[model samples]
Structure formats: C-alpha cells, structure tokens
Target: MRRSVELEIITEALSKMGPHTPATRLWGRAPDATADMAAEGNVWAGDVHDVALHIVTRLYGRPGTPREASPLAQAEDAKRRRDMGDEIAALTGAHDQLTSAPWYPARPGDLVHVHYEQAGDLPPFGETYIVGHVGAGLMSLQLLAHTLPETVPGLDAEATAAMAGCFAAEAADCPVYEAWFEAGPRSLTIVRDGRPVHIGGAP
Candidate 1:
C-alpha cells in the first residue's frame, strides 16, 4: 500500500512537472532521504484516525516558518512553501468564504456543517456539529452527528488508513499533533468553496 501510494504521488507529481517545476506537487513532510519513504513505511499512518496520512496525495499545511533554519533556510523555506502553495491558497480562500457565509465565525449553540475538502471517500467528508466555543481563531465544535470511524461511509481498512495520516503542524493546539507516528484528527484546514461544500442551515 505504501509503495502504491508513493508511486501514485511520484507519478502524478512528475507528470505536472512540465516547464513549471514544482517544489513537489505532493505535500507533507518526509525524511530527507527518498529511501526513507519506503524503508520507514512513511506513506501510511499506523492509526485509524488519521485520514490524510493514509493517502500520500492528501493536501495539507501548517502555519509557520519552514522546518529548516540554516543560512540556506530562506531558499529552502520558499521551496517547501511552494510544495504547500495549493494548501495555503485553499486556506486563504476558505477564510474568505467562511467569513462571508451566515455561519462564518460560528457561535456556540449554532449548528453548522463543516466540509472536509478533497477527502475522497474515506474521510469525515462533511458532518453536522453544534458550534461550541470560538476564540483565538480556533472554533470549538461538538459533533452533533453520530460519526464514528466505522459510521463514515466507505471508510474501510485501506480507506481508513488513508484517512488516518497526520497532517498537523507545530501551530496545532495540542502536542499530540506534533508527532508524525502519533495519529490524531488534525488535517488540512484549507478547503475550496467551489469544490462545493454540501452545507446545512444554522439553527
């Protein structure tokens, strides 16, 4: 499965190479050595909770400077960010769209449907939740729907593996997000409005 996903990513990324070279069409951080991708079985997450880690092609990002900070770090940072360009753009657009929607800045007791973009079939996709607390740019949501890993349609073992990948960053509110081997619910917060978020009314 790891080899398959890696091949898919490499193949798809290389195809888009053309004259416009990409930092890497595939997002997420891997070991510096390409061999580690296989040796360490890094493509798939060990836990069932991380969907993005299961799929190597999952698009996601963390907010902050690049990991490297040496003299050449500037260039490296630019390159790394380029790999995540799509994610950043999507996030910026999500902020714009959500802020404009009736549900923007969701309030406590408000019911809203949060959409999971590009999640294929193995993710939470979209689910209903009651808004909890909102502060410091992080809005707490208490899931209203009875959504368990199994309850999510099409979330089989392989698909479950794809969904379990850790896409969290250092900016994450909790430390569990920092470990790659540790699986969590963290994911690419960016989403496209036009990809069409199937929404529900706020109560």
Candidate 2:
C-alpha cells in the first residue's frame, strides 16, 4: 500500500470522530508499533484498526485500568487540558503580537542587546547579551566577551551560549518586551548605552 493511500484511510477513519478531535491524541498511539510495521513495509496493510487501537491503548491505557492506584493519574486529565489551554493562549496572543510588530531585516553582523532576568533563586538582575545567528523568527545570542565577573569564575563560552539560549526562550513570554517574529524580517528592540537604537533606520 502506498503511504498516501494509508494516510487517506487514516484521515477518513479519524474524520468520523469529528473535527474537534485533538490531532496529537490521534497520532500519539502506538508510535513504536507503527514504526516497526513500516520497517517491514506493511504499515498500510489491513491492520490500520489494530495500529489505531495500539495508539489509543498507549494514550488512554487498557479498559478497566485502575486510575486510583496511581498518584500521578489523579489529576492528569485536568492538568493536560489546562496546559494545552495555556499553550493555545500563548500561541494565539503572544505569538500573534510578535509576528505583527515592527521588524527590521537582520544582517550577519548586526548587534542585538537582549535584556532578560536571571534564572533561579537570586536577586532580580538584568543582563545584556550579544546576538549571533539571526533568523526571521529566532535569534541565537551569547554573553558579551570581557563581561564576565571574577566572582562567577570558570564560566566558559559554551556555558554562556547555553544559558543565553534558555534566557531567549523564556524572554519570549515577557510582557515588558514586545518582541516576536513572523515570515519576513526579524523584529526586536536593540538597546545601546542605556538608550534605544535603530538598525538601518527602522522605527
């Protein structure tokens, strides 16, 4: 059976479950079993129902399975829905805000100063980072050279880069900075010497 045909069958069957069915739940079933079947080149055979059942078993487990026995299962469904709701809200609100903001086409040597709060338990402090690789939606940055404090000691470039990446992802949730990305040019506010600066005269 061709892959396209198999997909068509799966789509038709799943469509019967209604349009609002979560795609993740539909695809989350029996991933390993599907892969094994595919390795044998027989995934699109007459076992589509079996493969789908495998997926449902993985997601919801066997019928009559005791949920009260496990502490972790107590609030799993509620938590999953809540987390999914939060994710959808962020993607719709913050993501939309970012993609629609003013943008400038980033260059190879462009400098970006990212203002982010430090992680973990410590006095709240902001640090500056230098941008490295820049894309329309994402930018990689690292700590500025010669900016490390003597007290920190042994913080190498690799560690700094890793930390910067974490901070950048976290900073996306920050309301103070109206930074987001879309298809064309990258959008972010660049600050220098305690003042806002524009690149290529972008407002």
Candidate 3:
C-alpha cells in the first residue's frame, strides 16, 4: 500500500531534520519568522519557539572598504555556520517540546505538520518542493518557485536533487519523470502508472 500524500509530506519534512538537531524549534533558529510563514508547524513547547538562526558568516574579518563579493562570501560563510549551529539547537529544543506537543497525536487531514528532527535553517535560495498526491493514478508535483523580480535568483541543484529523490516511488512507474527531469527546476512532473507527465513551469 502506498503512503498517504500528507504522510509523505510530513515524512519529507521530518527527514529534513538532521541528526544532532533539536526537536523544539525544528524550523530553524528564528521560530517567529519561519513558523509564522506557516501556522501549522508552530507549536514548540506550546508556544512559538525562537526560530531565527544567527547568521554569522563574518568571522574571518570585517567587510572591506569596497564591500565586494569576496568579503560578502566570507560573511555568508560565517552566517551559514551560525545558521547550522542554530539548527542544531532547534533540533534539541523540538525534541523536548515534542514530548508534550500535539504532534504526537497527529490526525489525518493535517497538511502542515513539522518534523522535529529534520529541521534546518531556511536556505537563502532555492524553492521548497511541496508534493501532492491525488489518488486514482495521478500525483501532482508542486514547486514553490523562488525568484527575484529585480535580479536573477540562485538555485541549489543539489538540494533539488535531494527533494527529487524523495519522489522516487511515485516517479518509478510514472512517465512524468522524464519530462520533468528534462525541463529542470521550477517545473512539475506528475507520475501516473509509472509514467511522468509534464505539468508546467513553477510560478
């Protein structure tokens, strides 16, 4: 029997919570900013947990006079590390909170469930893949397109790869995988009878 679509999403979200991460505040370091975006995932310790990761990518040195990419890169690196550290903390906190949170008694029709262990700091770029399965031989693939109107936004191919891997079971027997794979990011592929059907580019 195939897993429910909501279960798949919950599992997918939970899988993101990496090892050594806290269960409380699993949605990164700044709970307010991250969880507030989606009300479903905000119940750490029966309250809103602090979820903002302290971006610290500036330890190497201060910004240069010109403030070029080199200095910016350094700052970014530091921030990434800090974010990672904050993620770890969230994992722990979530663990403690889960003991009392309603997550354990989760019921059906819950579209927005947060996994305590797999939470990580929201990436600077890249879109979150929201998977939807409509039974009767069709699963809809939704991509939360991330882009900038002013500038070309960056994409994390590796992260996309990871998210794609999770859809293997549905894609294994669907024809949509080929078309979706060819079109690339911000695209959707539906799998039916092991065939992936090209949906369209993400908005």
Query: Considering every candidate listed, which one attains the maximal TM-score?
Result: 2
Error of 2 at 68 (Å): 36
Q: State TM-scores per candidate.
A: 0.28, 0.31, 0.19
* Tens-digit lDDT track of model 3 for 79-162: 678875434443333333233433322121212211111214433332323345556645443444433122222536555444
Model 3 residue 148 lDDT?
18
Model 3 regions lying over 4 Å from their true place: 1-90, 113-152, 156-203
lDDT of 1 by residue, 107-173 (tens): 4444433334344544445444444444564445444453326544655657654443223222223
Poorly placed runs, candidate 2 (over 4 Å): 1-83, 118-121, 132-140, 145-203
Instruction: For each candidate in the order shown, give its overall lDDT on alpha carbons.
Output: 0.36, 0.37, 0.32
- Order the candidates by lDDT, highest first — what do you get? 2, 1, 3
Candidate 1 scores a C-alpha RMSD against the true structure in Å of: 17.6
Q: List, in order, the clash count of every candidate structure.
A: 8, 3, 39
Question: Among these predicted structures, which one has the highest lDDT?
Answer: 2
10-129 per-residue lDDT for model 2 (tens digits): 545764563654333333324446544545444333344555555433332322332211112322443677766434443444344334435433333334543333334322233344
